[model samples]
Target: MPGLDLPAAATWGRLTTFLAVYETGSVRAAADQLHVTPPAVSAAIAALDAALGTPLFGKSGRGIIPTDAGETFAGYVRKMLGLLAEAAGAVRDADRGRVRIGAVATASEYVLPPLMASFIDEHPHVELSLSVLPRDELFARARDHAVDLVLAGRPPRLSGLVTNARRPNRLVLVGRPGLKTDPLTATWLLTGLGSGTRDTALSLLTRLQASPPLLTLGTSGAVVAAACQGLGVTLVHEAAVRAQLDSGELVSYTVPGTPMDRPWQLCTTSEPTSATRLFLAHVCDPGRVGAAAFHTRHRPQG
Candidate 1:
């Protein structure tokens, strides 16, 4: 309520405009979505800045980008807007139950299916939707309230969100059978930019003093395929490439400092819906779903 003491109409307009700009990353795009002129959008943001007594956005390379303050404020605005939408929906149909979940490829392919099955069994009336996305995109979707909750790698620090660490994912360097272990000399296959696996791979390469990757694939599956064909070594969640590893199409190397233990997390808005809370409890409770089902599949044997 501290930030809500302003004139209601003006405050709502500016906040919504700010959120549109933040999500779209452009004044012109936000204007188009809001059905207003670009200049009008600029004016609204300027006025809002004046009211708040701090600059929220800064110019960056032919476009506007959020300042740290803007990013933080945008999170609050998103939560407020989401709560409003939920309130309206509840008024219309109080009994309606739904949840939208976004997940990274690792969790989506391995961890989510069984958990989702259990959730559906327990709460047959709840409507559920799951989106599989890369780590950065998953965080963006969660921040913008596009999904009620996101299950993925340990999320980066973002304002107005809560992260509940669930289980650990082990990352290993894998490649075609009989591949060399010298990372500096070996070609690297990696996921596209902004992927958590790609970040981890790069970090591992840096520690090993390796050169830049030779190829960047768009998905984990593609990386696995390329590795199987002797393209290059890749770092991936061990469970993701389990079948290939078992079939002898791929081999895992025990790189010093890996299998890196990256924790999986459940990220949600600071204020979660009742349905979202229920689903989180169901998934996070080890007695119900159990950590073994989530973490024990296809673990590498030394």
Candidate 2:
């Protein structure tokens, strides 16, 4: 049969060299393009011809012309190479087409809405999914590769994670606008288990040497809402309750060493997905994030 020999030892190099030679119509020209010697190109073509049991080219002056079989084979080889390139791109497109972004409740509630909206507007084709989890759960998911990017207060140091962006974060004690209850003896609203806010709140209490009446709430939102209704006083991330503070729904109390500095961080694994990188770049850009995302003119008391 005047077809391929189907030798088990046949290598991809032969077909590629044959195609390169076919394209340039000269061994030396093909060798230059491939960054190999003319002898190497000729040897590749010879090996390919031997495997196929047919000479794929014929002499034409100083150049070469494909035989009938070589001409036919070039078609299949061209399609094969084209399909290979397409396959590679298809795999990468999947990664680039979707973004998995996770954040702690405070960041998601306060900072992410506008930033996410802008990101969607800019990259309309990307499918974005956002999850709001407790700080510990968020970092755990990051370790497991279940999520692409994370935003929260300075997370505990972990291997294989990188903090890509940072901004000032302040935790403050807040209550209803005109509450006269002394914070030292007032009921302290605390968040539920697995939240960083609870630990921070407790630590602040220890520092102040006051153990007020404690109320356990399931979420920061719940705690803040409870405080607003004059139920009790609560500790919250300033960014999380920015809207409330500005609207006079909540008042920051004056306390020594209040407004503790806990920086908001955007974190990702050492190796991140293509979509993650795109979103990371967007969030890091000051122009994209805008002043309202984190910067505010209102003076909050805490």
Candidate 3:
């Protein structure tokens, strides 16, 4: 039989079905969306194949995967769907106002709430969505248009974004209540095994000429917990474990001559939307003190 042709056999429904399976990568999942049985969706795929004279997907272990051709096609399909959604929204919407913000887990939990609360109070009608992710994920999401802004510790270099909310992060060493250390101890416990903190700690160690640390942790909170159990010494953000310090569960140690500081920032893509601008303005307003105010108001008694 001669190969079937697109003009003779194509339909919008077949394209929609193909795109659905392509996006989700499963026949059963596509079936769930169309409210049909898996076999029915498979039949649609068969019809689409006969019409295009090419296979779109291959069956894998309990799932479906798109062919290379289908993968390329799916990209265009997603673009089309996005454009369609945008067009439909443009026609029906009057005020398209929503800000999606991303932050690292620590910043989201400890730093962003007061800023966000102030923003919402200023613009009560604006919708807000906040995602608490890891450092890399937060920046990646901002790059990919998934979020309007990202707030995290300032990385060395970020492409396609501007540093707007910059502050000097106060980092300090913490140890158990009675764990004594000489001014020139060789051993250390570096918080965050990740590269940025590791590099910073290594530089500090190099300057101090201290030996490699006994432990390297992946989180400041873990460092605090370990110190509480008298595990070892670790460096971390002062704000992160401030409560523990005030309660005498952890105590800050002076680093002799080293200034304990790191830089933090709020980042947004170069071409920020109106929503992003509003959020940035509210968070960094000079006169609008939120968390900074709270910390100043209830500073721990010396």
Best by lDDT: 2
**Local accuracy of candidate 3 as per-residue lDDT tens digits, 116-162:** 78777777767778887667767766665566677777652558867
Q: Going through the candidates in order, what is the number of backbone clashes in each?
A: 0, 1, 0
lDDT of candidate 2 over 114-146, digit per residue (tens): 888998898888788888988777776676565
Native-to-model Cα distance after best TM-score fit, residue 255 in candidate 2, in Å: 2.4
Residue runs of model 1 more than 4 Å from their true location after superposition: 1-79, 86-96, 134-137, 140-146, 285-302
lDDT of 2 at 108: 86
Q: What is the lDDT of residue 91 in candidate 1?
A: 43
Q: What does candidate 3 score on TM?
A: 0.64
TM-score on alpha carbons, each prediction: 0.68, 0.64, 0.64
Of candidates 3 and 2, the better by lDDT = 2
Which stretches of candidate 3 lie above 4 Å from their native place?
1-96, 181-199, 202-219, 255-259, 290-302
Cand. 1 TM to true fold = 0.68
Candidate achieving higher TM-score, 1 or 3: 1
